[model samples]
Target chain A: MSEKIDFSHVRFLVVDTNRLMCQLVKDILMMLGCTQVTTARDSEKAIANLRAGGYDVLITEWNLKPRSGLELLDWMRTDGGSPDRMMPVIMLTANSEVEYVMESRDKGVTEFLAKPFTADGMYRRLVSVIARPRDFVSVKGYFGPDRRRQQIPFEGPDRRQQKPE
Target chain B: MRNKPQFIPNRGELKRKAVNYKTGMEIKLDEATLKKMEQLVENSSAEFLSETVASLKGLREALGRAATEPSARKEVLDHIREEAFQIKGMGGVFGYPLLTEFSKSLHDFLKELEDLDELQQEIVSIHVDTLYVVVSHKIKGSGGPLEAQLRASLKAAVDKAKPGTKPAQ
Candidate 1:
């Protein structure tokens, strides 16, 4: 049985310096029936808001004016103050460089958005991310009751599942 | 639900291209007319600059209106298409290749406007700004060197635009 997605009570945090972009995304999200959406212009403000909680998903620009989104993600990974990685982050970037995509993957970013995406494309990515498992812990040296790290043994003959830290 | 009736092009649609109500004489862009156009550019006045500014202001107003009202947006967009097409034809005839090229680009932007979401508005606004500068220079009779600036700005805007899944090129 397929489950119906309910976004009426969900909240999304959008971070981008462009006024027109912020408004446009807000409008599109509203059209998608999202309620209680918040927007941040820079990484600093976005980090602050992220600490405040209540955000279900984050849609952030790759190139921000003050600090880039990659820096923000790095800070979140290093900072012990944030909650255990529970929300999905969608990086909106114009950079399609292979190096950038590889960096994003290494950092554990959930997904990426290329420049000039359509409304439906944005909607679909959001839906897919929301439905996926949100268990991600970016910190290297962290072990506590909140941490739910599980190591699965490799079954295949050749492939190996790297040991957990 | 009922569908609106569609009809073929009437006498008005088939008529020759001219401001029919303005005067009975067709305004053809001949060599003499091209020379006169060149003269119009040479004797640029503050009023001419103001007139171009006024047109840009109208376009800005139309964009603002389109942001809110769907029907009004459609009407304004259609008007822009018609005006831009006319401008493109006239610019080519007058040997203003830059004007013709920019007008064609602006027309493409306007055509693609409706298919874009709100997030794309920033780049669209930048395009509008560039067009405004082009128009301003045209009015000043000094658009000879600004072509490079306009093209670079346009490329930058396009580069910054986030790619959509639908391939919004």
Candidate 2:
């Protein structure tokens, strides 16, 4: 593929209850050539920053202390959110069973990373997600400075595809 | 009678290796942690296992794509190195000493891939193949045995890189 992902522009927000996972993911993103990486230990912090804007990607662990990771993913999938309903999410967890893939697909998860991941694996997943991120609407606003509702249509070639207000 | 499945000896041998790996690693843990993990292993629902397996599959696919990128070779090798480091550190935490050792050796072997000209592609292929085996073992619920195999492979790869050792294992 001749496409080059503009590294400086891609922003990431990582959410994981596990400190190890967060740090490891941050390091992996940095290694993958991602310059902007923000981390949150829980959904509340992640959502707060997410509301504030600027993250191009969201990666969260499947298991959490206060709430389940899937629950958080469900909340983010609703109509009114920064990512809208189509934001790209990569779920990282120790749960490596087969059935969960179906469940994650239903929740709009773009990718999954089992715990004990290698840097190469993580980098590739990040590349694939960034290359084709899910675009959703944030109830509060878009990824930019303005709070204006933006629809990122992922179905066709034109990424800037619009929807009727 | 509960429907019974016939077992081939080779498959049984592989399963036996897996179980032996689990038992051997169980001895390395402290009393408290081992007990806790045992409970977790027993109580773990099938749903959790399935999710873990899917993630591993995704990771395997990612590795496959990365191997073909000749220009991204350096970046990909660095990524592989990082993976080995994480596996080494976390494998022990998760009760897999064999994986930790495997990760250590794999990380070392991956480092060698950064410089060699003639053998670089070959080394990359070996690493990816080893990774596939690891994922397959995990799916079969024999991640520990896979770890054992990986450790041996990593060690052999590392040894080959050193002076005086045979380059092929």
Candidate 3:
């Protein structure tokens, strides 16, 4: 595969209730050559940062005090004040389960990375959200990155292909 | 929901800003770069050890208070669950999988029980104590046979304590 990434301009917001997690992620980001990294312990603080704008990506843990990361993702997708509904979010948490993955996906999370995450894994996610941004979907209830990852060929009579409203 | 899933093209602001075809910066992390990142995490191992020790101390004290004070049990249990969860996420990150394993079990157990019974409190206490031992000795990896058995035994004790209900994950 080809490699094309530059973290010099990408601003990051990491949300986790644990000070250790926040520090670890920030350290990893710095190691990856990112200088503009902000830390938020709860969803509320995360929102304040998000509203200020300029954050290119969000990395949050699932278990947060007062408000969960899922709730933060929900607000980003659905809240009117959210500057970027299509903002890429990476859910990095210890809640490693199929159910959690599916739940985060439904909540419009761009990526789901379980904890005990490697720096390599974290870097890969950053590359994806930055270098290869995913197309978004906006429907009645949900508004964020499109959840469907694969595009299987449909050998059927009528297949609709158009930019949705 | 819309009639069809709309595919809103990403304006590629991030891509434009972060990717420079001129510089051709390879997003892939090389071995040396990866090593540097690993060292960054490993460098914090000492911090993890000391902080975890203090955290477990808090967990133990909270457990003791929950045992003696009936009124504090509700709030204390919530705090323990949150603390255990933080521990669960950190241990494996700092080369202490056993710490994660035990605390994850503790966290899940706390999730299952709204209020701790006498047996429940004892089992939770054991979980807290085991966590203390793991971090205190700087036990890394998943641990040996005895440690594995201790994890299994904790699960068994939870099953026995709860009887009919399955433990939360």
Candidate 4:
């Protein structure tokens, strides 16, 4: 793992309603050498900024005013909301329940960071998006990163490699 | 050879417009900077907890009012639930992981308020009392035997109040 990330030019858009939480995120990014950071207090404003373009990544809370972050992700992936549909998104929330994790994974989220996250935890997610970008899967009812992080050896035939009839 | 017109593109102007894009990255934080940011986060969390304690006091007052006035029960319970939700979400972030756990239990109890009989309401009151103690003491992390005992008693009461709802642990 190289310790030479240059976030000086990577633009980020942070969407969170809580002022304190937003400032904490901004400070963390700034400390990481990110200079181009934009913030939106709600989903509507986030959409407007996304449409304006030039953002490299997005960090959003699960709960937001007017629209939830899940809802925003839905629009971004399905409704052609973002100019770059492959843009990486990290979903933040206090709820670490399995249901919420599954929901976010199904909704095309690039990464999920639970609330009360440490600086190291956040840094790992950022590195994941930039260093190890996941391939997008557009199968039935799913249109996001491949949910499987590990590949298991199989004795059976490889279905993924089978040619279409 | 005849001297051709000299052409010099403004180097400074080109430098200003050049975009420096680099991907496949890793963040490296110096020890001093990391320590400073951690301290800032801690300070902010302490301030947040102080403010939260004041809010909790207000919630306790609202609970008292609800217990006394039947007409205000619904509204007061709603307010308590809202506050409990906030506590559940923020407690872990502010270094009070135990408070987050307790508040989650309280939030669940509040959700089933309408189904609770008088005995069940009493169980909820016990939970409220325990939360007050936990927050006032500024308890953090996994509390010791005392906290365990508090949780066990509350669970027993809840089981007595609403049998068959919770599976035996």
Which has the better lDDT: candidate 2, or candidate 3? 3
**Each prediction's TM-score versus the true structure:** 0.45, 0.43, 0.92, 0.76
Q: What is the DockQ of candidate 1?
A: 0.01
lDDT, model 2, position A79: 36
DockQ of each: 0.01, 0.02, 0.61, 0.14
Residue runs of model 3 more than 4 Å from their true location after superposition: A151-165, B22-25, B164-169
Over A32-114, each residue of candidate 1 has an lDDT whose tens digit, in order, gives: 45677999998889988989887767888776747788777655555667642535677776444578776765665667775
| Candidate 4: tens digits of C-alpha lDDT, residues B4-48 | 222221122211222223432334555675676677577778766
Better of 3 and 4 by TM-score: 3
CAPRI quality level assigned to candidate 2 from its DockQ score? incorrect
lDDT of 4 by residue, A23-97 (tens): 778877877778889989999999999999888888998878689999998878777556666678899776567
Interface RMSD of 4: 16.6
lDDT of 3 by residue, B81-134 (tens): 888888888888788889888888888788777887677888888887788777
Report clash pairs, candidate 4. Answer: none
A24-101, model 3: which lDDT tens digit per residue? 899888877788999999888898899998898999999886789999889888887988888999999999878999
Better of 1 and 2 by DockQ: 2
| Per-model fnat list | 0.00, 0.02, 0.70, 0.18
Q: For each candidate in turn, give its C-alpha RMSD to the true structure in angstroms.
A: 24.1, 23.2, 3.3, 10.8
- Candidate 4 off by > 4 Å: A1-3, A151-165, B1-34, B64-78, B111-125, B160-169
DockQ of 4: 0.14
Ordered by lDDT, highest first, the candidates read 3, 4, 1, 2
